[model samples]
Target: MMTQGTLVDATIIEAPSSTKNKEQQRDPEMHQTKKGNQWHFGMKAHIGVDAKSGLTHSLVTTAANEHDLNQLGNLLHGEEQFVSADAGYQGAPQREELAEVDVDWLIAERPAR
Candidate 1:
């Protein structure tokens, strides 16, 4: 059966700091990303999975500083009935992209409280 929905998310994987190394240099591929008040330094793993079956369909890696929505299009196969993502993907550009592909956007909504 075709995929009914796609779930998209991103996680930060920490790496050793360059300053602590002998060369005092960091991995250029790794970068810093801030979520709320906290900061994380590493690489970002962007994953797309079949929501109903829980099978991974795609993955895209990038510097931690990259925005999740920037890689959203790459995660889709254009066969899902809808796409669900975190609130970070709730924006005009993202919505427009989903619209272009004729997929329903199911982005998480922020709580009122």
Candidate 2:
């Protein structure tokens, strides 16, 4: 059964950066983004899973440069009692679009290096 708590995260779906296609250009829909010290080129797959059942409940795709937090609202089902996400989603609660959302934000803190 679906639960009221949702876990949200994103992964990069990498694509070749070479412009070898018929148009001799990289896919317009894909974009480049940096992670840590490496640069990734492609799209991002944002997913929301039911915390209890561990089943995916929502999904959104966007250019790799898009911030994970930008898709937070779309990943939610609007019935969540709480939302859990990684440090990438920091400041999500402060976003104007999500300011009125009445749910606990269990965003993780980045570990000290």
Instruction: Give me the runs in candidate 1 sitting further than 4 Å from their true place.
Output: 19-24, 92-99
For candidate 1, lDDT tens digit of each residue in 1-113? 54799899999988865534467667778888888898888999999999988999999999999998888998998899888998888882435564577778888898787
Scored against the true structure, residue 102 in model 2 reaches a CA lDDT of 93
* Off by more than 4 A, model 2: none
Report how far off residue 91 is in candidate 1 (Å).
Answer: 1.6
**Lowest lDDT 10-residue stretch of candidate 2:** 18-27
Error of 2 at 89 (Å): 0.5
Model number with the top TM-score:
2
Shift in Å, residue 74, candidate 2: 0.2
